[model samples]
Target chain A: MLKDFFRTFSSMIELEFRRLKHDRTEIYSRAVQPILWLAVYGPIMGSIRAIPTGNIPYTDFITPGVLIQSTTFISIFYGLTIVWERESGILKKLLVTPAPRYATVIGRAMASGIRAIFQTFIIILVALIIGVKFILNPFYFVLALVIIFFSSGGFAAISILVASFMKTRERFMGIGQALTMPLFFASNALYPVTMMPKALQYFATINPMSYVVDAVRSLIISGDLTNLWLDIVAIAIFNIIMFTLASVNFKKIIE
Target chain B: MEKAVDVRDVVKIFNKNFRALDGVSLEIESGSIFALLGPNGAGKTTLMRILTTQIGPSSGHAYVFGLDTVKEGSQVRKLISYVPQEMSVWTDISGYENLLIYSKIYGIPKEERNNIINGVLESMGLHDVSNRLVKTYSGGMIRRLEIACALLVRPKILFLDEPTIGLDPSARKVVWEKLKMFKKDYGTTIFFNTHYMDEAEIYSDLIAIINRGKIVTIGTSEELKHSVGGEILHFILSENGLHEDVLRELEGIEGIKDVVVSNSDVTFVVNDAEMILPHIMTFFNKKNIFVRRVSITKPTLDDVFLKYAGTRIDVSGRLSEVTHVRRMIRRG
Candidate 1:
């Protein structure tokens, strides 16, 4: 059974990888969008003195947030393909196959997680070019990538869970857009949670994206291990819940 | 002989308001090609999904090879493969890649996977285009590729829902030939849904006709055709049309089971065509209703359907004549 799970999971990931590889426009856009934000939006936002970053520059402060933003955008949109698959009847074909439901969803999450890492890499490279410095620890960098994968996976699960109910492209786009902005803004991705109003601050604190950004920031800028484990534990629990829900819902929607 | 599929009193309802499958039941003999004939929305696809283990029936049971489809879906899947109504292949990927993915999913050992993919592709006559993206292939090639993928696992039973729905006649023939070869070579039980009655009549060993989510009839071509136990008579009028008295006069003739009059033709179902032809000709002679042409044929599956369902299976508009009088049959 374990062999079956891993075989199905790897094949699904491979399918997604091949699909993205052939899609030049998607790869180009995925690579270009984050760099644009890093080079364009980061400079403009960094100049504001009102922004709170204890010692790190605002550009560096927003770097982790931008990485999380890129991950959120990519992960949320990953589900649009599921809607397309449903329309094209691929989902029906796959559902009839022997592949496990959770494996299929996990493979998809891993694929988009891998894509999120590439997009994050582009943002980080642009950050270096734009004069943002990191602690340059290999361990922290690997830890940051792990955080990105799970956080992106958590968001991808939410996207897939909602997507399973969407039978049409227009409905998927509407829900995706509705969820994307709120998830990004409610978290500390673009701003400090301390600077937000009380209600928004409350949402930011519980938001999984907040933990991901905090974890990344701690590893890269401050080189602080404090709160690192907390963020990891929180994101891990969030992923498990979201993934279990998504997998269960995936089978239900088809029925 | 083992039964490849057994569906007993299966009922499927959607949203508590719609009953998609209403007490549908059927049994398909192992290693025989079975075709399901139904009009649109007749629950053919629903029943196929149930047997394929993609969905559960609202009530009752469905089994494939003695295993309950709902309870032993994984075991059932190992013994069967499905080709859905739609084109399920990834258009952007090469045909080889598509087969490779399925081979892995089917858990073919790593060493034999490539050989099985190659063998299946070659058998489907898709080897030449194996490296080409599916989008570049013609509709027929894509359909063949779907079959090739299904065959990689060497499933004992292959379920195809409208396997050749939108293809050209030649393409449809190619798909059928491949399916026939697959059946012959491996003795695979092939169950399929088709809009083409002629295809169903010719290719299937046993055919089951479903109407309004119930099995109207199940038999071989000859048995289904002979179900009505009569012959059909079609009379083409000489433009002057039928006399008002003709139907009344024909009803008086012995062995005439029923009569249906249309704009330019009159069709009759009778116990024996030879016995009734002379009486019908004499009646037309007396009424001055010109019979331009007369053709007598053994009962068709269409007649079997009209006998049971009270309407012709109207895939082709040839059943337009039946439509005009179908309500009369229903009312009676």
Candidate 2:
């Protein structure tokens, strides 16, 4: 049974890679957003100095946030592909297979996460070129990659969960648009959590994106492993919840 | 021996009010091609879905090879494959890649995957275009590829829902030919639903006509046409004459089973067309009704459908509405 699960999971990831290889344009296109943020938004915000980023340049502080933002955008809209697959009848084909339901959910969620990792590498390269300094520890760098992957996986699962109920692409898009900005802004992506009002800070503390930004930021930028365990635990719990919900609701779309 | 499919008292109600399949029950024999003939919104797709284990029947049981579809869905899935009504192939990938994905999902042995894919591709007449992206293929090639994907594991039962809806006549023929080959080679039981009367008549071993979520009639093509039990006589009246009055008058004639009129054309079913022809001609001659043309033919599946469902199966205008509902279901 376990072997079947792994085979299905790996097959789904391989299918995504094949599709990615055929159309590398999405990877390049996704990079444009992060580039604009780092080069344009980053500098303008860094000069303001009103956000109290502390010691590190504002651009450097927001680098991790921007990376997670790019992934968040991709992960949240990943359900659009699910909707398209449903419309095109591919989802029905896959569902009729002997593979377990969770295998499909986790497999597709991981595929989206893997796709986000590609954008991670692109953003890292752009960050280096723009003179954003890192601690350069290989261990923490790899750890950050793992965090980003599962974090994005969690967000993708949330998207799939929404897709189960939303059925139509237009309604899914409308809800996705309503969701992304709030999730991005409510987190401490652009500004410090301490700078927000107490209620907003509570929301930021609860936001999974905040944990991703915090863990990735500290690991890559400051090389601090102080809150690393806490962040990891938070993201892991978040993933467990999202994945379970998404898997449970996955079959509802067919109904 | 277990039947290929056995559905018993299956009911599927959508959104509390729309009873898509109302107490549908049937059994398909092993290695036989079964056609479910129905008009749009007649529960053909819904019944297929239930039998394939894509969705559970609301109030009853469906079994594939004696495995309960609901309780043993995965095992049933292993034994059967389904080609849905909508286009299921991934357009961005090459045809070979699409098959490769299914090959892996089906857990075909690594060493034999390529050989099997190549063989199926060749059999489906897709080998030459296997390396080409599916988006570049014509509608027929793409459909053939979809069927190839379903055949990878040599499933014991193959279910297709409207396998040739929008295809041209030649394309439809090609699909049926490939299906026939698969049935012969593998002894696979083929089950499909279609509105095309001739397709059901020619390819199916047995057919069941469904209307408004009920099976109106079920039998062999010959049996169904035989059940309608008469010869059809059609007369095209001259454009200057009135057809409705003639249609009414013809209905009053003794021994005419049914009379249907469209514009200046009148068609009636009679037990003996030869015996009725003289009397009808003499009546028309006395009334000065000009008969432009006349033809006598045996009853067709269309006539059978008309007899059971109270409507022709192939009303051209309803074709678009069928496609529209299918699209709406896809969107949902």
Candidate 3:
């Protein structure tokens, strides 16, 4: 049984790699959009006011948030692949193939996670070029990457669950884009939670993306993630809940 | 021999009002080509979908390899391959990659997958286009590739729904040839659904005629043609018209089973055309009506559909006529 699981996982990775190699334009757009956020949106918040978590340059402040932000935005594109699969009838083809049916969704989510990491690394490299001090610990960076991976994966799962319920690509795009902005804005991606009213602060505090961004921000900027153990446990619980909800909802919607 | 697939009085209603399949039932032998023939909306695709565990029957049950379709879908799904009517391949992947993904899913060992993919592609005559993205490939190529995917898993029972619906004649012939070869090689039981009567007549060991959510008849093509028992006489009369009573009398004359009137053209299914044609022509002559034209032919599967399903190919506009297909073939 364990052997079967690994076989499915490896093939799924191969499928995702093929997809990445298959679409060069997707690669360009993925790189270019986060850079656009880096070039423009990352600085506008800088000149306005001292960022909530202290006098940290707004770039460094929103840097982790922007990575999570763009990653979350990119999460919905996973549904575009699914929508195309549905239109091309590939979903039906995958449906009847005997083993590892859920692997299709898992493969896609993990592929998009890798995509998120690539996009984040690109943005971080840009920041590094501008002389953001380098942190020397590989373990914390790896932990931070895991936090983003699970966060983006939870978001991708929800994206797929939504895609299963939608019939057409156009409809999914419109609805996916519409939902993305509100969810991103509600979090601390653009501004810290203390900048918000009491009610919105509660929501931002509970936003899993907020936990993810704050955790990563501690690693890159402060070098000590505030209450590092609590951050780890909280985000783990969030990932469990969201992934579970997405999988349960995934079966119901597709059926 | 045990039944490979058995659908028992199955009924599928989509939204309480839209009835897709109504009380349909049949038994498929372990290793034979069973063709379901009908026009669009005739419930052929719906029945296939239900049999393949894609949907549930509203009022009955289906069994595959002695496992209930709804109750034990995974066991059944493990053994059969379903190639749906739509083109279901990734537009961006090569035909070879498509097979690779499915073979992996079927848990073929890494060492064996390449050989299996290559062998299937070579047999389907797709080796040359194996690396081409499916979206850029011609319709026929994509279809053959889908057939290759179904075969990749080496399914014991294969269900192909309108497998060659949009292919050119030459391409369609190639697919049918491959299917015949596959059946011979593996003794795979094929449930082939199609709207093309000629394909059904040529390839199916047994044919089931479905219409308006019901199976109207089922038999070997020869048996169906034999059961209809006669020739068809077609007459086109324009300037003169016969009284309804007179036409009725001619229709009742012993040799005929049914009379079909379309505009001034009257078609009749009669047992003995040598006797009926002369009588029909003489009746028109006695009425001083000019005979525009007349033709007669032996029983065809089309005639069997007309006789048993209460439909005439030309007059029943509810379904596309054979003439439409003939025109398409001519146009192509």
Best by lDDT: 2
* Model 1 / residue A71 / CA error / Å: 1.6
lDDT of 1 by residue, B1-332 (tens): 78999999999998998899999889998999999988777899999999988889999999999999989998887899899876678877789999988888778998998898989898889999999877778867978998898898888999998887666789889888888987888999999987568888999999998888898889997778767887899999887455666568678788888888888888999877888899888888887777889999897777777887787766655234333332222221
Please give the lDDT score at residue B229 for candidate 1: 81
Specify the highest-DockQ model's number: 2
lDDT of each: 0.83, 0.88, 0.77
Q: Is 1 or 2 the stronger prediction by TM-score? A: 2
Give the poorly placed runs of model 1, Cα more than 4 Å off: B232-296, B316-332
Off by over 4 Å in 2: B232-296, B314-332
Q: Say which docking band candidate 1 falls in.
A: acceptable
Native contacts retained per candidate? Answer: 0.74, 0.76, 0.62
Clashing pairs in model 2? none
Poorest lDDT segment (10 consecutive residues) of candidate 2 chain A: A84-93
Clashing pairs in 3: none
When just chain B is superposed on the true chain B, each candidate scores a TM-score of 0.77, 0.79, 0.76
For every model shown, the clashing-pair count is 0, 0, 0
Per-candidate interface DockQ score: 0.40, 0.43, 0.36
Q: After superposition, how far is residue B62 of candidate 3 from its true place, in Å?
A: 0.7
